[model samples]
Target chain A: MSAAAARADAGTAVARVRGLRKSYGDREVVAGVDLELFAGECFGLLGPNGAGKTTTLKLCLGLVEPDGGSIDLFGYDLPRQAREARQRVGVVPQVDSLDPDFTVSENLLVFGRYFGLSDAQVKARIPDLLEFANLSGRGDAKIQALSGGMKRRLTLARALVNDPDLVILDEPTTGLDPQARHVIWDRLKQLTAQGKTLLLTTHFMEEAERLCTRLSVLDQGRVIATGEPRALIAEHIEPQVVEVYGDGVDEWASAHAAPLSERCERTGETVFCYAHDAGPLVASLAAWPGLRHLHRPANLEDLFLKLTGREMRD
Target chain B: MAADAQSRRTVARASPWRLPAFSLRALHVWRRNFLVWRKLAIPSMLGNFADPAFYMLALGYGLGGLLPAVDGLPYIAFLAAGTICYSTMNTATFEALYSAFSRMHVQRTWDAILNAPLSLDDIVTGEALWAATKSLFSGVAILVVVWLLGLADSWRVLWLVPLALLVGLCFASLGLIVTALAPSYDFFMYYFTLVVTPMMLVCGVFFPVAQLPDWLQSVSSVLPLTHAVAIARPLLAGEVPGQVLLHVAVLAGYGLVAFHIALVLARRRLLR
Candidate 1:
C-alpha cells in the first residue's frame, strides 16, 4: 500500500490505470481493474490463462481501446496523448516480431531510429545491446536462422533499442528451456538493478515469485488479490500446505479433514489443506487411509489453485 | 495564499506533452528492409513488365493480325501504354496493400514505430514515400524494356515516367486506404480481383474505351488511372494536349485526399 501511495506522487507513477473495463461484445475481458506502477520498481501480474493480463497491458499501451477506463502513462492521457506516452516506453510482445529480412544489428538499428535516434547514436548502442542480449557474435545472422531462444532474446533487445524508461514484457520466458530462462532472468535482474521500472505478465508462478517485488493475482478479469508475495502468502493463504494423495481423497477430506482444517480443497486424486503449520497437518494426514501422502510448505502455485479452481474450460 | 499558489503550481506541472527526441529510428527500420526492396525490385518489375509483353505478344500480335487498327496506331503500341499504366497500378497497389498490411498487422512494425516518437502520420507518409519509390523503379524498368524493343513511338513519351509515378501515387494512396481497412490478406484479395483488376481492364488498357458505350467511356474518364492512361497514351504516341494538365491536377488531388484519409484511418487503428 505504501508503494501504491508513493505512485500517487506525480514523479513516481510511470503508469496508472483506473477502473478499466473492456468487453468483446457481451463477454467482458477486463471488468474493473485499478493499478499503479511506480518508477524504479518491478510489478508482476500473476494469473491463470485467459485472465486478462495481456489485455490489460494492451490497454495501457493504447493497442486496444478500453470500453471504459483512464490510463495515464508518464502523465499523458491515453489515447489522446498516446504518442507522448509511447515515447517513454518499450514493449516485448509474446510473439517474436524481429524483421525476418534484417540481420540482428540491422534490426536494432532500425528500431532505434523509430525513437528518433541519430545514425551515429544507433551505431554506438549496437555493441552494448548485442552483448546484453548475448547476440554480439550473431549480429550477422538472419532472423529466420535464429533459434526460438535467440529470437526471444533479440525481441527483448529490440524493445530496449530506444533506451526506454519503462519496459513491458508479456510472458517473457514461457516456452524457453531452463538455461535460456536463467540467462534472461540474469539480464532482467541487471536491468532492475539499473533502476529501470518493469511490468511483467506471466502464468508461471515461479517467474512471478522470482522477479516481482509486488504482484497482483487476477482471475476472471478481476484483481482477486494484490500484495507482496510473502504478505499475500501470510494474509490470504496459509504459510504451509499439506497435500494428501489418493483416489476418493475428496471424500476422505470431506469426512476426516474438512471439519478439522481451516481450508481444505480437493482436486482430482489429491486433497490440499492450507494451514499455519504442516507439522500437525502431517500427523493428522497419517490417520486417514486415503491421505497416505504428505507434502511440505505451500507457495504461489498453491495460492493460485486455491483462488482459481481446478475446473478445466476450453 | 502561498499554499494556494503552490497547489496551483503543482496542477500546472502535470502537463502531458513531453520533450520529443526524434531519433533516426525510422531510417534504421528503412535500412533493415531495404534489401527486401531489392528482392522485390526484380519481382515487381517482372510482374508489371510481363503484363504488357503478354498482352502485346498474345493479344496484340495474335489478335491484331486478324483485325484493323482502331485509331491508326499499331495495336502493340496502344496496348503498350495501357500495360505501363497497369504496371504502375500493380506495383504501387501491391507495395501499398500486401506489404504494408503485413508490416502493420503481422510483423507489428507499426507497434514498433508508434512506440517511438514517430506518429501515425509519419508512418503513413514514410510508407507512401517508400511505395512511390518502388513504383518509380518498376515504371523505369518497363519504360526501358519498351524502348529497347523499339515500341516507344515518341520522344514525348519520356514524360510518361513522371505521369506513371502520378498514377502510382494515386493507386498507392488508395491502396494504403484499403490497407488501413483490410483486416486480413484474404479480405484484400476480394478488392484486387473485383475492384482494381476490373478497373484496369475496363479503363481502356488494350482497346479504346470509345469502343464501349458512351456512358461507360464517360465513367472511365473520371477515374485516376483513366486520366493517367489518357495523358500517357497520347504522349507515348507523339501527341500532347493542354488537357493533360487537368489530368495532373486530378491525380494530385486524389493523392492528397487519399493520403489524409489513410492518415486518419492509421491513427484510429493505431492509437485506439
Candidate 2:
C-alpha cells in the first residue's frame, strides 16, 4: 500500500507531520516532508546517509525544532505539548545513550523514573522487561560488561519500560551480527503484536522489508516515494534482476550491449540487468561460460537504489 | 490536518524564552543522579573531602605561624571558614563542569532523559542542584573537622550548612553555564584558571580581601565567593553577620541568573 492508502486503512494515527522543513544554516536538511504513522503498524523511514532521515525522526520527537512544519503525536501538539505527548512515547536513539554508570537493571529503573513511574512500579516491571530483552540474569552487570548486542537489546528493552503507545527506533540493528539482529527483529514483532506502533529509520533495506509494513523513501530531504515493500518493488522496478559479472564480463557486455536490457547499472566489476522477464537474459548469459551470474526477483533494495540513485551520500 | 496547519502558523511566532520551561519533574533527574552517585559513594565522598583536607593542612596550619591573625582571629580559625566556602565553590564547579559534561555529551544521558517526559530545563536544574548537593558533602566534612579541632568559635558556625548550600548553588550554576558553552573536556581549563582561580584568590579564602588594593576589593566584592566568605566568616567567629540579607541576595542573584542562562544555552546546544 502507498503511504496515503495505508493511512486510510489505519484506524487511528499515532503521529502526523505536515510540510515539515528543517535546515542547518544554508543547507536544507528536511525539505517539505509529510508523514503519518498509524497505530499497530511498523512504519519505516529509509534513506542513505545525510538524507535527513535522522532529522525527520528527531522532528517527530520534538528533539529538533522544525524550520517550517507542525507535528501532532497522539493528539498533542509538538514542543508546546511535547512533554505530554512524550509521556506515552518511547525512543531508542541512533547512538547508545545508556548510562554507563548504572548497571543494566539500574538503567531501566532510572529511565522509568523519567516518566514519573514510582519505585515500586518500576521494580514490578523490571523482571518482565529484562526477560523480554533476554537479559534476565544479567541485571546486576554494569553496562560496560555487556557485549554490543547485549547493550542494543538493553537499549530496546529500556524503551519499553514505560509500556509506550509508540516506539521510535533509529537504525535499531545497524551494527549487530545476524543472530543478534534476528533476536531484535523478533522482539519488535512482538511489540507490534501487542498493538504498539513502531516508527523506525534504517539504511538496511532487508531490515525495512522484513519489519516495515509501509515506508517512505527519503532522499536529499524529501520523500521520493512511499509504499509497502513488495508493492513498491512491483510498481517502481522490473520484476527480475540478473547480477552478471566476472572475468571478461565487461567485454561481453559491451559486445552485446544492444540486445541487453535498457535499464542496466554497472558498479565496479558487476553489472545489474533489470527486466520483466529473465529468460532471454539468462539464455544470452550462457555465451559467457566463465562469467558468474545470479538471477532473482527484484526486491526493496532495487526500488530503493532506483529511486534514490546508487551514489554514495557521504 | 487543519489544526496542525493552524499550530504551524503560530510556531514561527513562538517566544524564544520558551526554551527553559521548568517543571517539578526536575526532582526525577536529581533522583537519577543520586541513584548513580550512591554506587560509588565512598570514593565520591573521599574525593570531595580531599581538597579541603589538603587546604587545611597546607594553608591553614602551614602558614598559620607566618600570617598574623585575620580580623582579630587566629589564622587557622579564619582559614577554616574560607575553606568551607572555597570547597563548596570548587566541588560544585568541578562536578557541574566535568561530570555534567560527560552526561550531556559523552554519555548522551541528557538525550536519553529528553526521550521521556522531561525537558532540557529539568535536566539542567537537576544537574545544578545535584552538583550543589554533592558540594554540600565537602563543606560539611570540613565543617565537622573544624568543629572537632576547636576552630569554630561559636554555635553560629552551624549556619555554615545553609551557607554552603547557597555557595554551592551559585558556583554550580556558573559552572553549568560554562558546561553549556564547552565543546570538549579541554575547554574547562579556561573556566578553572580564568574564572575559578581568580575567585579563589580574591574572595579572601587564604588572605583577607581587605588587604588587597581599593580597586581590587571592589572587584572582589562582586564575586559570589566574597559574599559567601563574608557571611561564613562572621558566623564561624561567633559574631552576627552584618548586611546578611544583601549577601544572600547577591548569592541568590548569581544562582538565579546563571541558572536561567544555563537552561537557555543548553536548550540551544542540545535541542537543535
Candidate 3:
C-alpha cells in the first residue's frame, strides 16, 4: 500500500519539514533538508554521528528553531504554532528525561495532564501504556531506581501519555543491549499498528533494517538516498556482497575485480565487491591466497557507504 | 464535509489555552519534587533561616548590647525584619537559579514538558510562581520563629509576608533570566558570589541604607531587595513609613520587566 493510504485514511501529512536548516556560527548543522511523514508511516533517519538527523528532529519538534525554512505539524507552522502543534505530537528524546521525582505512574499522569488530559482520561490510559512499555509491574517505581532500559521504556511511555498523533524519537536505542533494543522495536511497531506516525533517528544499521519501513540515508547534513529500506539497497547497491580483506585488497580490487564486478569499494582493510551474484566474485577471490573472505547480503550500510563514500569521518 | 469543517474550527478555537495546560504540568512536577525530597524542605528552610538568624544573634544581641538602638527600636526587632527580607531573596533566588538549571539541563525536564502542550512562557511563569511560593513560605516561617523568641514585637510585622512575596517575584524573575543565560552549574556560582550575594548584603537588609556612603546609598536605591527591606523594616518596627508605597511601586516595576526578560530568554533557550 502507498504510505498515505496506510495512514488511517487521514489523507494528511502529520509532519512536513521544508528546506529546514540549522547552523552554529558558520557551520551548517542541518542544511536544506525536506521531509514528510504521514500517519502510520515508520520513517527512519539513518546516519553516522554529526549527520544532522538529531538537529532536524529538534527543529521539527520546536526544541530548537531552524536557521532557515519552515516545519509544520499537522499543517501548523512550528515556531509560531508550537503549543498548538505540540498538543498532537510527542517526542522521545535521545537522552532519557523522565522526572526522577515521580513514580512511573505519576510521571505518566503528570505528563498527560500537560496535554490537558483530565484525571479520569489519564488514569484510563495508564494500564495500557504501562503494558505497552513493559512497565506494568513497575508503575510505582521511582525513576531513579529504574534501570537504564526501564527508564528508556518509561520515556517512551511518557511520550504516548497524551495520545499524540506524531511521535519523534531521536536515536531511541543508541546504547541499549540487544534485548532492550528488540523490546523498544516491538513497542514502536505496535504504535505504528495503531496508525500513529513516527520519525526516528538511528546509527545502528540493524535496528533500522528491522524497524523502519521507509528511511533516508543522511550524510554531512544532507540526504544521500531515501526510499523503502529494501528498495534503496537494491536500487543503489548490489544484492550480495563479498568482503575480501588483505594488505593489498584495494590494489587487488583494482587489478582483479574493479572492471569485472559492478562495483568495488575499500572500507578499512576490507574491500567490498558489489555484484548481482556473489558466486563469480567468491570464486575469483579464492585464487588470491591468504586473503580473508566473507559473503553476506548487501544492506543499508553498503548503500550508505556507496553514497557517502568510505572515509573515516569521525 | 460540513461536519469536518466544524470539527476543524473547534480545534482552532481551543489553541490559545495551551500555555495554561503546560503550567499545570509544572505544578505536577513541583509537587513530585516535593514528594521525592520531603527531607529537603526542612534543610532548605533552615538554610534560609540560619543566615539571618546567625546575623541577627551576633549583630542584634551581641553587637546591639554594645551600641545604642537605631530609631529607638530594640536591635532584635530591627535585625529580625532584615533577616527575613534577605531570607526571602535567598529562597527565591536559589530555587530559580540552581534547581531550575538542574531540571532544564541535567534532567532534561523542560524538554519533556515542552513536548506536551506547554509553551516556553508557561514553563517560565510556572517556575517563577513556584520560586515565589518557596520564598513566601520561608519568610513566614522565619517570622513565626522570631515571634516565638520575643524578637518581633510589632503586630504590624504581619505585613512583611506580603512584602516578602513581592521581593520574591523580583529575585525569582532575575534568577530565571540567569538560568536561561547560564551555560553550566559553575556559572551560576559565579553569579551567586559576585552579583546575588552582594545584593543581599548591601540592599538595606542588614544596616540602614541611609548610613551607607553616598554612592553606595545611590546604588542600593536601584535594587529591588532594598525596596523590599525598606517596606518590610518599617512594618516590623511598628512604624508605617509613608515612603513604603514608593518601594512597592519600584518592586512592581522590577517584577514586570524582569518577568518579561525571563520569558524572552526562556524562549531562546527552549525553542530557538
Candidate 4:
C-alpha cells in the first residue's frame, strides 16, 4: 500500500506509524515500516533477535525517536506529546526495572503516585491490585523475596495501577515457566475482554498464536508479513507437515522421501516434509525401517520460517 | 481524544526553557527514596557522620594543638565550620554520584519512573532534590556536634541549615552532571580525585582561602565550596557576611547551570 493510503486507513488506530525509520551510525535498525494498532485488539510483533521488535515497541512508546516518519499514538504526535499519550498507557519493559528498595506493596504505591494518584487513592487500590497479581499475602515482602514468576506478575500489576487503556508488554514471559506463562496469558485475556488494547512482542510463535488476534512478522527491521496467526499459516504454508528424523534421514530423502512430499527442508539431522496431505507422506514413511516420523497440521512457526527464511537469527 | 489534544496544545504552549516543566510528581520519587532510606536510617546516618567526625577529631583536636588559632577562633573551631560545609558537599555529591548512578543504571529505578506520567525533568530534579535533602541530614548532624563541642559561637549557627541545603544543591548538581556522562562506576573515581578532592583543599574548607597563594586564591573564589565556607564560617562564628549576595549568586549560578546541563545530558542518555 502507498504510505499516505496506509496512514489514512489508520484514523481509528490506537497507534499509527508511517514510513518509520531509525538508524544508528551506519546500521539501519528499523527501516521503513508502517503499522496500525486498532483499539481493543491484541496485536503482536513477532521476530527473532535483532529483528527490531523492541525498537518498534520503543518507537510506539516514544521512548526512542524515529529517524524519519510520523507516529500518532492515541491521536497525539509522539515524542512531542509523549507525556500526554503515556498518561493513558502502561508499559512492561523487557528488562526488570522494579525498585528493590521498597516492599512489594510499596512498589505499587510509589508507581501509582507517579501517575499523580494520591497516597490515599494508591493505598485503597493496593489490596485489589495485589490480589489481581496473586500476591495478596506477599505485599509486605521485599522484592528480593519474590520468585521470578512472582516478580513478573508484580510488574504486570504495577503496569495496571494507572488503569491504562493500552498495555504494552515486551517479551512478558520470555524467561518464565509454562505455568507462569499461562497465568499471564489468562490475565492478558481478561484485560482484552474488558476492552483494553494490548501490544506485545515475542519470538515464541505459540505465544503469538494463542494471544494475538492479529500480528506482524518482522525480519531485519522490516515487516515481512502481517495477518492473523491462522490466516498467515493458511496463506503461506501447506496444510500439513511430516517430520522425518533419526538415522539416515538425509540419504532417505534423496532416494525415497523427495518424490513423496510437495516440499522438503533439512536443518541438521531432521527433515521436514511439507504437503497438502500428510496421510500419504506418513504412510510412505512407514515403509522405511527404523524411521521415526510424526505428522501434524502446519502452525504459525512454519509460516514464520517460510516468510523470514529458516536461517538462525542470533 | 479531546484530552489528548488539550495536553498536546499545552505541550506546544510550554516555554522553550523546559526547566520549569518539573512537576510535583517528583515528590513521589523523593518519597520513594525517603522510604528506602528509612530502612537503613541508622547505618546511613552513621556513614554520613563518620567521615566528618573523623576529620573533626583527627585534624581538629589532634592537629589543632600544633597550629595557631585562625581568625580569633581555635583551630578546631575553625575546622568545625569547614567540616559542616565539607560534609554537606560529600553527602550530596556521593548521593548524586554512586547512589544515583546505581539507581539510574544498575537498579533501573529511573526507567521505572519514566514509564509513568513523569517526565525526565521531573525524575532528574527529584533526584537532585532528594540528594540535597539527604545531605541536610548529615549537615545538621555535624552542626549539632559543632554546637555540643562548643565550636559554634552563636545562635546564628542555625542559619547553617539553609546554607547546607544550598551547598547540597550546588554539589548535587555538579555530581549529577558527572553522572550523566559516566559510562560505569569506575568513572566516578576521576571526579572524586580530580574535582572533589581539590575543591576540598582550596575552597577554604581546610583553611582560609586568603592563606593560599594569590593565583590559588583567584581559583578558590570561583569554587562553590568557597562560597559555602565563606557564608557558613561567619555564621558559625556569629559575624556578618562579606559579599553575601555575590556568594549566593555564584553558588546559585553553578546549581542552576549544572542542573540544566544535567537534565539535558540525562534526557539524551536515558530516553534514547
Best by lDDT: 2
Which number leads on TM-score? 2
Q: What residue pairs are clashing in model 3?
A: none
Task: Give the lDDT ranking, best first.
Answer: 2, 4, 3, 1
Which regions of candidate 4 are displaced past 4 Å? A1-12, B1-20
Docking model 2 quality class:
medium
Q: How do the candidates score on chain B by TM-score?
A: 0.85, 0.94, 0.86, 0.92
> Each candidate's TM vs. the true structure?
0.85, 0.96, 0.90, 0.93
Docking class of 3: acceptable
| DockQ of candidate 4 (2 decimals) | 0.39
Q: Write the per-residue lDDT of candidate 2 for residues B35-77, one digit (tens) a residue.
A: 8889888888887887677778677778898877878988888
- What is the DockQ of the complex in model 2? 0.61
**Which has the higher lDDT value, candidate number 1 or candidate number 4?**
4
Model 3: CA > 4 A from native: A1-11, A247-255, B1-39, B151-155
- Models sorted by TM-score, best on top: 2, 4, 3, 1
Binned by DockQ into CAPRI classes (incorrect, acceptable, medium, high), candidate 1 is: acceptable
Q: In model 3, state the lDDT of residue A106.
A: 87
Single out the weakest 10-residue window by summed lDDT for candidate 3 chain A: A1-10
